[model samples]
Target: MPNATATPPAFRYQGWSLFSLLAALVLLMTVMILIINPDLTEGVRSAIRATARSSFVLFLLAFTASAFAVLVPSPLSKSLVRERRFIGLAFAFSHLIHAVLIYWYGQLNTEFWPGRTALGNVPGTVGYVFVLLLALTSFKSTTRLIGATAWKRLHTTGMWVLAAIFAYSNFKRIPMSDWYVLPFGLICAATAIRLMGKLAQANKRQSLQRVA
Candidate 1:
């Protein structure tokens, strides 16, 4: 018989299943946005925007999962920590769609690429490089191949780079639309939460050492 005092298994979404669901929703949303807009070029642009927003949300979740799990210690936060890998994968997938749409837009609208300066492109190019690296190294086989220390460094650096890119992207757009402030504010808050969580973890370790 099951022991009465035994705790039930905590509810958590399966990793790949969660990734698949999130990815499908992103695709569905993109398709709906495209269909709703009559102009093909405009539709593609809108889809690009939509995917960017979705990717940002997913990235934030993965970025702060551990922090939330540590600071809040709720089932939901713990579940996020458990499923961070897949959530990050879903973010990469969303960005892949966003990239494809951007490319398609450039092809359809010849002026699209020419309008942006080389310097303006550097941050996005670097961000994609980090995204690709992070996604590739996320697999167990690849993580093992790289060694745990290297993997941790790479992930840590990549996340910070991506966070900076997101913040910069939104901050630069505020002049065009006040709405950009919302995402910029969110990234700032997430950054603070992550930092606090790290500090809390360090303090906990120090306390344990003192007790010892």
Candidate 2:
């Protein structure tokens, strides 16, 4: 018989299974949004918005996973850290859908691309560039090719850049609608959590070194 004091193993969703599940959910949600809205252009726009929101959520999870694990030290937080890679990939997948819908929307609406200034597109374009680079380097083979140090630098930079982009994207929209404040506040809070986690880890390391 098992010892009564033994702890149960933490449940986790990992590998391709987690990615597939997340991707399927994003796809299903996008399809449902499109189907529910009868207008083709409006439906596509709504789908784009839906995918963007999904991408933001996945990005936050991946971005904060390590921090949460360090700060909270819970089974769920540990699972998130383990599953961070797949969750990041799912974010990439959702953003890819967002890109595709944007392109489709542009094709359907003649003024869509022309109406936007170059400056207005800069943030999103840079964000997508980082997303593509980060997604490409996510695999073992690619990470190995890049060297561990380089991979770490790239991912760290990419995540921060993406976070800033998200914050800016939402902040700029606040003028359009007050609802934008909620996401902006969320990003700010996530940033604070990550920063606190890093400080805690650094302090812990220093303490261990001093004791040793």
Candidate 3:
């Protein structure tokens, strides 16, 4: 008699794959924007802002996934948990485009890169550093190298830094245009959820300690 073995199921598309597809589509669209309007200075600046907005959306999705999944226990939120890393990577990719556009803007118009002392300049630069750190540590190898506790510390601090940067950047822009309110509100709401989640976690820890 011949021995039979069970074959594993074929690979299915899930969070990471979907995220890569979506990132590619966004990049294609951004490229098309430049094709349509060959004005590199203003056009690149517009693309940078738009890409930053999209990246913020992606970051929020990843940021809220785990907390919301536990809070609401829905398939969508849980799916977000599974794809959180992918979503984060997608955010990084979006921001990469944003960064490139910013550089292009600077090159196209020598005065485009504002002074570091300018309102958003310093914080934006800090935020990019955090983004790079987070992106580097998103992988299993880097996480292992950093150790679990250090990884948590780095990620937690980085998340808050990015959140504050987003909040400040949008809030500062409100004087220029009211359209900034949307992103500002979204970041604020996400920050609220994060705070609530932290409070809930602390309460649960206290309850567990009392029981023990």
Q: How much lDDT does each candidate structure score?
A: 0.93, 0.93, 0.82
TM-score of each: 0.95, 0.95, 0.87
> What stretches of model 1 exceed 4 Å from their correct place?
1-12
lDDT of 2 by residue, 98-164 (tens): 9999999999899999999999999999999999999999999999999999999999999999999
Clash count for candidate 1 is 0
Clashing pairs in 2: none
> Candidate 1, residues 30-128: lDDT per residue as tens digits?
999989999999999999989999999999999999999889887678778878899999999999998999999999999999999999999999999
RMSD of each: 1.9, 2.3, 4.9
| Residue pairs with backbone atoms closer than 3 Å in model 3 (clashes) | none
Stretches of candidate 2 off by over 4 Å are: 1-12
lDDT at residue 132 of model 3 (Cα atoms):
99
In terms of lDDT, model 1 sits at 0.93
Rate residue 80 of model 3 by lDDT: 74
Error of 1 at 14 (Å): 1.4
